[model samples]
Target: MPISSVEKDLDALTMTIVAEFPVPVRRLWDAYADPRQIEKFWGPPGWPATFARHDMAPGGRSSYYMTGPGGERAGAYWEFLAVEPERSFEVLDGFAGPDGTPDPAMPTTRMTCTFEETGAGARVTTTTSFDSLDDLQKLLEMGMQEGMTAAMGQMDAVVADLASFAAGRAAELQILSDAQVRVSRVIRGPLRSVWDAHHDPALLRRWMLGPDGWTMPVCEVATKVGDSYRFEWEQEGGGGRFGFTGELLESLPPHRAVTTERMVGVEGPGTVNELTLTPVEGGTLLTVVITYPDPQTRDQVLATGMVDGQEMSYARLEAEVLTPA
Candidate 1:
């Protein structure tokens, strides 16, 4: 496969290499975001490269070296000038010594890498700017063209592996089924604190609101089996109010609970919501599993931005309830 093409403009004092990959932009971005992945394809096929230090952020520095056939190491360093996730970044590339220090005698190239999404997949354009024509020619004479071409050529195989791994990781995180929608979070506090945030009316009012400019005006929880609870959120500008009322079916303090939730003005029957908490090393792992009566209802709830709303609410709960308590 044609992976990369290099273009050199001596008069323009620039060298640009563009590569196309059949992978998601995020997977391609991981080639640079992860140092371990970069180490695998940073040099020509035979001269393997190893990174001593890699900090992928604006103003950060990365130091690495390539080992030759005779064990000769060619060290290089990059000073990151700017960084934008899944998009582009700028860096100053230069030769370095074994100690990871920049060598003043070597020419430095200003490099910019841009990642763009396309119909086919993702494309990356890396441009290197030289100070002068002589500087560009000097690097070319040092086998820069062959080195870069061979290095970037390895990206296709690397991206394929990364894409597969990313897909597997995403599948593990997604929680969607015919009858249920599940969400989980690790709250940065003890299990009891997280449980209290759900049962305590005052604490419940602080983080249960769905959207911005909404306040949980009324929150009541009986905290016992066969008991009922109700929560209402009123918009700030007198817009409107919405809430859910439920009956507790099972209660196991600070660990697990089962309840039923019915929207204030919804049409069909409510859903069964199961809440479980487990103690982790430093906090609590809270999981909420909601079983809908049908697939249509489950899809409707998902379409209403329920997942995003819950994520936002969980963030607030962590900051306000977990942190303060």
Candidate 2:
């Protein structure tokens, strides 16, 4: 109820984010109401929660199947608080089940997300509180800051694209001048299996975007640093115009892959992306890292439609690699 006063009233107050998702509190509240909405955006990026549950109340607990690339499941939970619908909900992690039962295996923290109705849209302020400085530091050290910031940017795009149970007219939205939106997926799959989906021309054609009616004629990958690859996609059949290309930055067999991508329409080769694959109990864990070499470019893309592409791409990758065939 007393927001700004949270600093004076609470012990060890922490500040993290303020995001405009282009949706009002009423509709944004709906996402919290329905379990399906939670299912859609629960994972970091490119990963889907295989098994998800939400009680949606003050005393409830939520769970999700953290399906990494190649189908490895890591479980996560959240304990809810202050359950006011469409207005606010606060949650903390590292708590035992409904009862006092304890589990020391997992690291935990607390989170508070408040929704406000603004003329601009629903401004969501999320605060991540830690039991100890160590917990907060660990999250930052593990790259949570950059990733969450990008995820919020991705959320704003989703809110913009949604058909108006909540919608902010494109014109009303202040254009992003410079902002970068990014997402990462930790994938665990067999090196050969992951490689096949990436290297096989036919398989690659199934996922990558196009201008429609595109065909892959030349898909070459070197799989090692300094190795160049060319991907040519065309619609006119013989001698067409569409094409995309990238050069290998570094490739670690069954371990990791990095590339610099260049497309036909874009300014130049942009994005130095890395995919690290780690072997898990029954599958391979693949982590995708996308970087914008220039800060200005990153900020510009974040302000523009870059996030839409990132979110859609992550969803597509989840479909292609994480799901069971």
Candidate 3:
């Protein structure tokens, strides 16, 4: 919704769109880098764009098609002329066929997108230069201005959704008593994948661990009622080693799982951890409620930065396992 104005320069044979987004320059740039994120808002309302392929780099090619209200499709391709990460990029845009072949009969434009950091957020400017004044007018008459405005507006929602998963942003850490702490993350993956990731040790080792350099060298899972499991991890240099063994109290595959967790090398009461995954648009919402035996026990865990550690683990899971397959 930070779109301010669309300007057309007849003498210069160009069109420019100016907008602001309350997110970091890197985050905004990622919207352009990820095709899945781009497809969410690459076209105007009711004309959703489907990207067949996207390679974001100099000399790279991206192919996509937009479906109109009446089911008609318009395909386009971008020949990336230059790329500069979170700074600026230039691309040659033109009409194309379903097979991603460029159409020589159609007009083309060279467009450059730039991003700048402001005190409040990031400012984005996009300028497209046509071959001639006549071509510029032709695109304007085709509602290019209004269509792009609407498409850019959808980016606000896209960035917001990304921010929701910004490591602990989706979770609320609450201390119910001297004995309970809860951590939740809204994962953007299907319920089944998330469920498997939690219940399958082989897949869990990929994302469920401490910060970089730490490894879950031991993971055993038996996700069944009355079954048991164990997890062991240590820092890269063999320092700060810790692990936990637990018994499964409840198991509802792809939905809910409960276990009694007892930690080693720590003097405190074991905790009851319940993990729940609920289906939601674009992914699943995961909530883990940990109940300690006493307020002293809860405070002890909090002092260990458990919340931040779990948040980091979930963030990794989101990037590696939660992405839509």
Candidate 4:
């Protein structure tokens, strides 16, 4: 077990757990920063987790759920209060309903996690403060301590598996639910560069083209919330023309963005795409969570080989836009 100690303070209504790992601090931090990696160890054995959204910046929120042995699910959410990148982060943690809404009846806790380097490797100290003594007692009775211990026990393996989550890999797709899917990739560029490539029309036109033998003729980009953008692509020698139009819903420079995307001439509801970028060990981790209108719509979009197209585009981005001459 990696856990060094677990201490509970009844007078202060707080509990602190300390764990050490034989890895560099950055490696340990990246495991938590990347949703794909963190989800592997967030839940105890026999209860795997799936994170639909994981924005690590302040004012952001992460929603996830754990599936039990018998197919039961327990949902939870975290509201990021502060993030000091690779050093520490604080969050308001609480239970949530299946829909990812916080359960007001359940007690919430403020948890602060600090990372530091040790002689051998690194250490993470997590301190969770309850609102009251009753709240602390209530959580302990619910196996909170045991669950945490079990969850951290799996982190050692995740942190050691560097090749799987390294940069230069193809984009990966994860189905969060019937209506939601998450696609992730690590770009060989900085966070700001990746974010800028998505916004700047010139930069986008250069790399956003999915496959060879195509040209992007129209590249209108949304600069702020509520602004609409359009993009159209045509095959070489004027074969077929297609495009997507969307309105920016939320924008947090260098970190996150949310938009509504649809086919230019389509009539039905569109998907809400949430994009998040985080600096990790290898490069910038880019995650896009798309919420479709329903399961059929989700399946239809994936059937078009969307992930493969995305991978090609990303590869182009690295070669044409991000790589230094």
Most accurate candidate by TM-score: 4
The residue-by-residue lDDT of candidate 3 on 1-325, one tens digit each, is: 7898888888898899999988888778867765556778999999988655455656566778898999888999998899886899899999997566998888899999999998988988999999998888888888888988999999988876665444335445755334655565667677788888887777899898957889888899975788878899988778777899889997656666779999866675698987766543345556677878887778878898888888888888988876655
- Residue-level lDDT of model 1, residues 1-325, one tens digit each, is 5355788887788989999988878778877755546767889988987654455666666767898999888999998899887899899999998767889999999999999998889999999999988888899999998888889888878777733333111111233346765565666778788889888888888887766788887788967799988888888977688888889997767666789999877777999987766543335556577878999888888788886777777777877877754
Clashes by residue pair, model 3: 178-295
TM-scores, all candidates, are 0.52, 0.43, 0.52, 0.98
Please give the range of 10 consecutive residues that has the lowest summed lDDT in model 1. 165-174
- What is the number of backbone collisions in each predicted candidate, taken in the order shown? 0, 12, 1, 0
Poorest 10 consecutive residues of model 2 by lDDT? 168-177
Write the candidate numbers in order of decreasing TM-score. 4, 3, 1, 2
lDDT of each: 0.76, 0.55, 0.78, 0.94
Worst 10 residues of 3 by lDDT: 163-172
lDDT by residue (tens digit), candidate 4, 1-325:
8999999999999999999999999999998999999999999999999999899999888999999999999999999999999899999999999788999999999999999999999999999999999999999999999999999999999999999999979999999888999999999998899999999999998999888989999999999899999999999899699999999999888799999999989898999999999999778999999999999999999999999999999999999899998
Model 2 lDDT tens row, 121-178: 6777778777666666665677666645544544543444344222111111112112
